[model samples]
Target: MDTLQFLIDGFAVALAPQNLMFALFGAFIGTLIGALPGLGPANGVAILIPLAFTLGLPADTAMILLTAVYAGAMYGGRISSILLNIPGDEPAMMTCLDGYPMAQKGKAAEALALSAVASFMGGLIGTIGLILLAPVLAKFALTFGPAEYFALFMLAFATLGGITGKNPMKTVVAATLGIMISTVGIDNTGVQRYTFGILKLYEGVDFILAIVGLFAISELLLFIEERAGAGRKLIQVGKLLLRPRDILHVLPTTLRGGSLGFIAGVLPGAGASLGSFISYTLEKQYLGKKGHFGEGDPRGVAAPEAGNNGASSGALVPMLTLGVPGSGTTAVLLAMLISLNITPGPLMFTQNADIVWGVIAALLIGNLLLLVLNIPLVGFFVKLLSVPPMFLLPMVTMIAFVGIYSISHSTFDLYFMIGFGVAGYLLRKLEMPLVPIILGLLLGPEMEKNLGHALVISDGDWSVLWGTPLAASLWLVAGLGLILPYIVGPILRRRMRAAITEDAVSD
Candidate 1:
């Protein structure tokens, strides 16, 4: 009953003429970013966060705009993946396996449309999950203790294996380094610990500065590197046409992927990449010979597209309900919530139902608007690829600089940007997953505050960590976070061997 009233208030907030327009614009720009190669949802959010803040919008509206952008960018990633054989991000790489081949077979328009529709399906399903479960999840979150939070953080840090490149060891090292960086400001005793006496260090290493350096700036550097060896366009697009049958063909895979992805996204450490991989493989398994599964099959395309988007929306559940971000963009959103002085977790439902429900309404509207805009504007969006990277990147960089400068009117920000950009580049070279670092920066302080409170409540009792069943279950999951990957790897290899044998037999 309370949830019902809360949603009504949320709709009122989201449907306001002004907020609606902002959400639409954010989704549109987000699609553009997603269309670009290498610049993903996380990077897009980081670069655009400054601009949204520069507009001086209220925190909820600002969040609405940015979340719309994040959602849109994910929507856009499928365009290039299917049409150009280039994935916009790791998650989109699965789409390209079948999408690019479909384009080669001259089904590009149909392929892109299928992806869009699947994305919508995934989003709708995920929104349902968020609506039905977010409130319940919020109630459950009230049970967290210091042990539970520490366990949750451990799970988040463990996700490196599920989503990262081949080096889990390096991923662990990188996450540990981030946690160590969190120790710089001061100890719980109020005495500065790792300040290094540089005056600037007195307040602790600036985590936001580190985030900008590692993600945004690093992205720019990679952009420069990619441009060094670029060539002229290899494919020509003739017409944008997709029949209704195309959408119908992919609906089954989309639903399956959506349900799986939503479950994955709600889990603390598992994310979209894992969900996409699993869905694509499973769809292939179930489809057998007729479904096309891989080789440009529309279902193959739908599976991953649906999975990624579903995971994206599902990722928000933990962030809103438990104050634990399931992915990087959610981490930023959580940070924004903190910056606005809005406390998230189970209690948030009782206290700020309007904001929570409003976000849900906005997310739904944002995905719908993305579908409406993307189908008709396909040609215009693909044209973005025609713009040389040199022009596009510099313009984006300039926008970033101006936006950041506007916040504090500080020239020093330009220097800060360059430095962070370089750091971002170095981190990339080191095989580090930038998202965890961002999560560390944004959530580090909050995690500590929660720990402090839990300890105080326990009067220094260590067992206070396992006070609730929820906390205990979370701890058990954290333990598995470390073990599951190793167990899964061998199974994956065996499956790959069987697939290879089948390929040989088919050939």
Candidate 2:
């Protein structure tokens, strides 16, 4: 009953005219951003952070807009996968297996419609799970002390490499670099660590600049290097009608995929890409020969779409409840909250109930808006693909410069952002995962603070780090998180790659 009341009040906040308008606009723009290949939800959110600040949006309104963009981007990623044989983002890779085949068969419209429906169902299921589970998780988290939190942060770092990158060692290097960057400012004891006699360094590296540089600006450089959006033919969407039987045919697959995705999303470091891959793989195995999973089967289109979108929502659970992001995009969103001076954790529910509930309500509303927009306005979004990269690149670069300048009004920050962008490009060239870098930056300071608190309480006794059962259990999990990747990563990657190759050859 209390949850119900809170939800109702949340609806009240989300339905306000200004908030509703932002949600709609965000959904519209996010779909355009997602329809483009190579630009994903993380970039979409990072590119828009300046706009939120420029407009001076309140905490709740900004969250509603950005969350809507996140959800919208998830829905829009399938458009290119189905039509262009190119995934709009990493998580959408599974969608291309059958989606492109359907398009090649002149069923592009049907594929898009089916994916839209699947995304809606998946997002809905995830949101309902969040409502039921977040409060409970928050309550459980209230019992945690500094020692438990330190262990929890370790678990996050340990598991991240397994889920997000091909090489755990490289992930560790990236994370260490980020932590080293984070340590550049004045410490709690008023001692400078790495200021290097520069006054600006006293405040440490501003994560906003780093995020925009790493995600948006670096992506722009990659686009230039690859000459993306060069000559490519788009598959024509034959008809806009979806058969009712097709919906019924894939309903079960969608439900199962959504459920599995939600669980995956709840686990730290297991993100949408994993959810989609597992969903498609499991459904293929379950149905065996009869399913024709990769050969333009509607179930193939539904399963991964449902899985990834569900995982996107599920990623919010740990982020809101435990201050740990479950996915890359959620990490960006976590940065948004931190920038707003809104700490996400157990107390968030009691201390900032309106913001939490309102954001939740906005997600529900945004999902509905995405469903409506994706099906009918898909043609408009697909047209976006025809716009050459030459035009888009400059526009994005302009936005980054203007947005960053507007926020800090500092010329030095602009140069610093460009430096990070160059560094990010180099990291990408080396095949290093960028999310771990952002996570390290976001969580490093907090981890240090908690470790300090625990040591002070234990009078410098190192054993207190894992003295309690909860802390010890977390440490055990962290060790497993590190070791299991070596054991499981190869098998999983090989199977997924084989599936992709098999399907592409079949088509």
Candidate 3:
């Protein structure tokens, strides 16, 4: 039977008015959640998981709603990152490098519109790839054992750490703190490391709460300080339409980033943030001094938006095909599937083809809907900044509190969120990048788990890390990622300096 036939059938299932309503509702709410600082795709989906059941939707229909929200949240995250110099989510952090500058230059509409278009293209590419490549990729991924997994995560850390922050050391420092924090809770072996006899500490700090504190709460503090004396001037929103030249300029970058992000997403543990950051780094290197990558270049805005959205969609590949959750959001998805008595493995394709393909169809439709919805609403979103700081700050803070409380339902988490908020503010004052911290928090435990599994399989022989071709290649890449940044940094600066000197002479 042709795969196309299954896809067509899937669309029939997804197009039901009830399922369509769920998808649209998820997309709308997801975008709103993503636009708020610190609340992201994971938080949005998690928040809505119970609602899906409450609505008495079927398991497949519920997943359609959650996944649509997942995709929509990723697309919406750039709104804050571009407009406020504050990332709406970890994946959106890369967008801020260029997006905020564009906003400051009165191109908020153009930046947001471009982001929406790029996201649509990326998500479309990813959903298509998922349709065609999931089975093949899933088989390949099955070969990755604990040793290979460990090596892959090391590569992620090295590469991600190398590309972020003004100084690699500072990024490393933030990452180290995150790792330490990750270890604070009970280990897989059942020993609590830093619980301090408090029952609530057994689970350690919540990554979601940390994100809310670090991005949303700290952002509020910074906004207040900025408004302490002279009121801030808001950037005027401009026309939302992009010129033909603008579209043409970003098209190639978008395609390249979208492809790269899909590949990254297919890999376990490599989520949207890593995909977007790596794409941004590659674009910066390729453009060299010409791109002005961190200075409002459209290429800068296009790359990460495409990458993150593509990665977000790509992350579903492993979950659907192999029953392996690739990222935090997908992990939540896996749980939801299990709760509904749906097993997600190789046989699932044959046994539950409708559920699988219906999700894929819904994802594509949701991306199309996001592009249609976000573009015309660009002006309305931009107007959110026009509110007075006194009013806006309280509202934002309260939203953050409510979001965290709703998820954890603990007063302890609320206080913990505030503490992390102060820490986030202080880190910002020290010029430390928060991206690495989030990455470390996400990856550290995964890395340790893989390492432990590898050791158990190899009787604690350390050389097992490089025992296989895949493992060795990954280790080599990790080594290169760690060293190459230091080597390339000085050389790039020298070249940029020479180019500036030549330009000055010509002038």
Candidate 4:
């Protein structure tokens, strides 16, 4: 098939001596951060952005390194979640649901093994999905017009309510602020809008600066809050154990989880946390009354692991095919790609085949590396849980600021980065999802340019927005994306709380 040939060609590119080393270095660093609590794939990628650019490497090598890091970290997150009962990020949350319990039962090794296998299965499934879906999806993506993109932007904005559980109204407000921040640079006519008479503001806000502030520095302030009271328990753990029965037991769960996760991740704004939830629900349905889900079922461990990992790969599809990032990590990656002068879309398939398929091949390698490293060296991975956030946060913040400065050696960008970090931190404390901000920033310019083009095509007519069925359908879906969160969020929260209380009482 075409996929096999692409992989074959990708190998020739990925196996080059320089690229192979990059892959290893990325996997190593990725594993370190992925095992650290609160430092998920997104933060890791963002923190390392400086390293990626400073080397001035070829784009394919850079993509290979970053993708491997991403792939490795997806599996690396499981180590802390299973051993320490602390999830490294949102995706690993479900792993803690059952994995932590299993650790308590002194089967930490078994739980670790199961997670490793499930991660591999999920990763492979996700990779297959990326290869098969990107081209076809790119064709579909080619149909999006400015109006459709604008509607998509609105839908992306609305997801703040559905994901950020602490305060929906605050999330919406924060997202609106982000949209406003994006609007400050220039209007559709390339004329400046919100510069406020400042000469430096002419070029607008740097998204890299904003992301660094939101993810890195803001987190630094949060870390300071828990500096002295950090509650970490060191584990003198034993070796991981694996058996054929454990493998067989989880195969069904992994397959089911991968399929569901891939589908869920494809939908705009839905991410690994949602994918894990969906997989857990589906597994419970299949289990009916037979499986003891929350009470440390091995299958319970497999479902979320597979789902989140599958979803991680699934997120890449949208970013590569449509230049739309469905999750925060992809948003960062999408920006990185754009900065590298790579445009992701239908043309990318024809033009950047090596970067595309090379990334795919690197992920496969990272998955294998994760599986090999996670099981036999369980003690090594568990020790990653001991890394302190206070130490880690500062380094990440430093990297973010430095990386922005190094890009073009701009002091104004450094100031903007810190400023954004402060604002981002405030939003984080408010529990407003930062993802909508990234999504809005990524698609906003495209929407503006396309809308202008559509008007020009239609001779300045407003009717172009709803003229085509494809555009009309996207608009309708986008509207639903905005509304579904508001309508379903409150009801779902109440029911979920009730269930959690019941489970806590039963436990």
- The candidate scoring highest on TM-score is 2
**Model 4, range 1-507, lDDT digits (tens) per residue?**
876898888888888889988888888778777887777888778777767877777899988888877877788888888787778787787787678778788888888889889988988898888888887887777667676665555555655454444366666666667667767776757788889888777766767677767776776677677553554785446666788987998899999999888876777767776777678767977998988776678998899889988998998987788777777788888877877889887678779988888888888877877777777766776764665665666666666767777887989778877787788777777667776676566666676677788788889898887788876776777778777767765665464455445544655
Residue pair clashes in candidate 4: 213-421
> What's the TM-score of each model vs. the native?
0.91, 0.98, 0.67, 0.92
When sorted by lDDT, best at the front, the candidate numbers are 2, 3, 1, 4
The weakest ten consecutive residues by lDDT in model 4 span 495-504
Model 2 over residues 1-507: C-alpha lDDT tens digits? 989999999999999999999999889888888888889999999988888887889999999999998998998899889988888998899999999888888889999999999999889888998999999999999999999999999998898865575687898988898888889899999999889899999988899999999998899999898966564678887658878898999999999999888887887878888888888999998989989888899999999999998899899999999999988899999999999999999999999999999999988999999999988898888887877888888888887888889988999999999999999999999999898899999999999999999999999999999999999999999999888877777787788899998887876
lDDT of 3 by residue, 1-507 (tens): 558998899999899999899999888878877876666776567556646654568977998998998998898799888877778887898888788778878888889989999999889988988989876755675678889878876776675433452477887798789788878889998998999998887987676667667765776788688753432345677778878888888998999889888987876556787678767778878888878766678899999999998888888886787565666677567656765778676667777889988999999899989998898876665565344567656755665677667655789888998898899999989989765676567567767998999999999999998999999998997788677756764564455445335433533
Clashes of 2: 0
- Please give the clash total of every predicted structure, in order: 7, 0, 0, 1
By summed lDDT, the worst window of 10 consecutive residues in model 1 runs over: 498-507
Give a tens-digit lDDT track for model 1, residues 217-320: 78888888876344336355667677777677777889999988888888766677766777778888888877764566788889988898889989999888
Clash count, predicted structure 3: 0
Q: Candidate 4: how many backbone clashes?
A: 1
For model 4 the TM-score comes to 0.92
> Ten-residue segment with the worst summed lDDT in candidate 3?
498-507
Candidate 1, after superposition: displacement of residue 22 in Å? 1.5
